[model samples]
Target: MAFKIGVYGSNIVESERALGLARELGQALAAHGCIVITGACSGMPYAVAKTAFEHGAEVWGFTPALNLDEHRRAYPQDDIGIYRRLIYVPPSYHDLFGLTPATAEQDWGARLKYRNVISTVNSDAGIIISGGWGTLNEFTNLIYEGKPIGILIGSGGLADELPVWYPRLRKKTASPVLFEGNPTRLLSLILQRLE
Candidate 1:
């Protein structure tokens, strides 16, 4: 089977450099025969999704949506320029076997957390571009869990110097989390690790 790479990032961007990096990272993953996995949202993740699809790579969207319609309506999946398929599951934490809902906000977060874990756990590795608090949480989860991860550095957002400041990343993450300046080379390395 092809290697699966869970892509972590946000649709929101802080600058042009960040967006450029995200696109390169996505293209690299697809070029190396690694399946691109995302939260099925937008921004960096979406950019990667498009590249993977365009390159004929198998793209999977592990969305937080309950169904296909919701994914299309609420997410940036209208045109599958890069992705091949979309899989929607409840993002609620209640789906975690035994969990009780506390409040409306908690319920919503649970759903996102639920899907995030599912996507990351199932992947052989991950790619973290620029992002915010949510991206950090996903990256941290994957690292502490001992998954091999790669970062497309210089993209700002989650890149440009992410691990330096985040102690948790240095502590739990198995460095050096493969950093690459070229997408193709980075993806090739990831594929080698997967094999």
Candidate 2:
């Protein structure tokens, strides 16, 4: 089976450099014979998935909705069609699994957490680029699971902040966590560890 690489990042990266880096990373991941995985959201992750798919790499996703309509409502800004396969984890699953509530006003936050867990659990490793709260949540999950993660610095947000904070956390594990600002080098490093 091809190694799966989870790309976790913001759904709203506007800077040209950051966007370009995400695409480059996607292309590199595909070129290296690795399957791409994402939260199935928009922006950076979408860019990565699109490039990776165009390069003939399988792109799997963990969607937040149970069906197409729900998916559209949940993530109207996202390009859901980019994913080759998406494992749907609905809001009710959280309540069924004792993670959240299944009320009319559903616990979307809890659902998102469950989705992130599912995404990281199925992947061999992860790459964190410029991101927000969601990306940080994914990174923390990966770290706790002792999964390898490559953080792309200079992309801003949590990706740049992690290098400064990871050491302060004083967490230790056998899993490899690498930080690099250069997209090419970061891709190479991640692929090396996976192989």
Candidate 3:
């Protein structure tokens, strides 16, 4: 299987520079023959996934919703066609957790968090771009799973802040968390470390 690289970032990126970097990262992943994975949300992650897909790379997405209809209703802004495979939280899981459609909105936050965990755990490694609290949650999930991570330093948000926090957040795992401003070099470093 191609290396699955999970991308975590803001769902509402406003910076042109950060958006450009996300596009660059997507192109680089496609060039490297990596499968791009995201949370199936909008903004930076969607930008990366769309670019990667356009470049002939396989893209996978994990959605917080239980099915395609719910995914559309919950995330109407997200483009469904960008992903080669879009995985939804199984209905059995909802049944087990007693998460009915009526209660889905009330528990949306928890669903998104668990989706992050699922996506992060499935990835061979991850990259963080401009992001907020949700991105931090995904980053922590990667750290806990001992997956290698690449933080695009100039992308702003958590990407810029993570390096400063890394020392305090370092865990026992040898999994490397690299920070770089350039997407190509960062991806190269991540791929090398994976080897």
Candidate 4:
């Protein structure tokens, strides 16, 4: 089976530069014969998934909703056209009521974090695009789990900040988290590490 690469980032607060970079990354990963995995939300994930699909890569989404109706309600303006497979993770009672930070054992952000966990679990490596709290959460999860990651620097948001914080992180990974602003080179480096 093709290796799955998880694409995690912001659902909102996207810039043209970030979206374009995401497309390039997707295309590169697809060209390398890797399947793209995502949370199936909007912004960077959608942008990446679209280009990956166009490049003939199989895209998979781990959605938080149980069915189509719930998905539509959760992401009314988003598109799921690029996903070759959609895995639904039903919302738990905690997801509906809990308001704490996401942990490895529990659902957070109304099961959105749970979907992030599922995405990471299914992928061999991950690419972090411009994002906010959700992206940070996913990045932390990947690092804690010892999964290799690529952070797209210069894309704004968390991607730009990771390089600064990475050096200070007390917990380290032997598999380095590669950071590059240039999309082509970044993709090449990520594939090199993974392959």
Candidate 5:
């Protein structure tokens, strides 16, 4: 099975540097024959997924919506074709929590949290670029589960901030976490530990 690597980052990135790094990471992941996973949102993660897909990598997405219709209606900017498979939180799982379409909009935070958990847990390891609170949530999940993580430093946001937080947040079972500014080298460091 191909190694699954989750790409976590800002959903509304504006920095050209960050976008470039994301694209580079995507291309590198594809070249390495790794499966790319994302939250199915826009911005940095989207850049990674799209580039990876174009490079013949199998890209999977964990979306916050309950179904395809909801995904389209809620995230019209997202290019769904970039993903080989898009996973949604099961309708039954939502129903159990009373999360219907009527409530989905108001409960978007919860929806994303659920999606993050599923995506983070499914991946063998994860890479973090420029990110915000949502990306931090995914990072914590990876840390909690003891998954290997690669952080592209100088990508801004959480990637830059994680160094300050890692010592406080890292657990006893946490796997090796690499911080590098070069996308290719960062991926190489991650794959080394994975192997």
Candidate 6:
């Protein structure tokens, strides 16, 4: 077995720069014989899944949705090409340690948070492509867990915001989330971290 790189980030809102980086890194990850994992949502993560599928590589979607019903309903336009490979993990990927926010005030928060942890755990390493708060949460949890992670930075989104955040959490990070530019380099760094 080679390695598994969970590519984490946002959906539906990404700049051209970030998308390009995601695509390139995705292709590289697949070519390197690594499975790419994602939230199975849109934006950068979807782009990477599409590219990985196009290249005939195995891609696993660690979903936050409760089940297939919610996945289809929420992601109306999910790429059928990659959707088939998804591994649905309900609620929160972070529910294990209880890092989830009290959003629903009922029982749904655990599902989402639990899914986040599942996504990070399934991955041999991670790539944080630009993203918003959800993306921030994923990045934070993985870093705290000390996983081998990487960042596709310098284009904006979280990439642009990380300089401030990195310094604050650098000490807490069990393992460094390597940062680099372009897809190939980003993937290589991710690969290196896994090795």
lDDT of 2 by residue, 76-120 (tens): 876666688988886468557765366745666666778899999
Off by over 4 Å in 6: 90-109
lDDT (Cα, 0-100) at 141 in candidate 2:
87
Q: Report the CA-based lDDT of candidate 2 relative to the real structure.
A: 0.84
**Every candidate's CA RMSD:** 2.8, 1.9, 2.0, 4.0, 2.0, 3.3
**By the TM-score metric, which is better: model 2 or model 5?**
5
Ranking of predictions according to lDDT: 5, 3, 2, 4, 6, 1
- Candidate 1 has a TM-score of 0.83
- Give lDDT per model, in order: 0.73, 0.84, 0.89, 0.82, 0.89, 0.74
Off by over 4 Å in 2: 90-92, 99-106
Which regions of candidate 3 fall more than 4 Å away from where they truly are? 94-103
**Residue 173, model 4, lDDT:** 69
Mark the regions of model 4 whose C-alpha exceeds 4 Å error after superposition. Answer: 91-108
Question: How many clashes show up in model 1?
Answer: 8
Name the better of 4 and 5 by lDDT.
5
Q: Write the per-residue lDDT of candidate 6 for residues 1-195, one digit (tens) a residue.
A: 868788878876577777777778767877888787888887888898888888867888877676788778768887756754677754444554556455654345555566788788777778887887877888877877788767777656886688677877636556776767777877777666666
* lDDT (tens digit, per residue) of candidate 5 on 1-195: 689999999998759899899889989999999999999998898998899999999999999888999889877987898888999978677667776555745667778999999999999999999899999999889988989999999999999998888878636866788899999999999988888
Report the CA-based lDDT of candidate 4 relative to the real structure: 0.82
Candidate 4 lDDT, 69-140, residue by residue in tens:
877877888767777898887545355556564573354355776787788888888888988898888898
lDDT of 3: 0.89
Write down the worst ten-residue block by lDDT for model 6: 89-98
Better of 1 and 2 by TM-score: 2
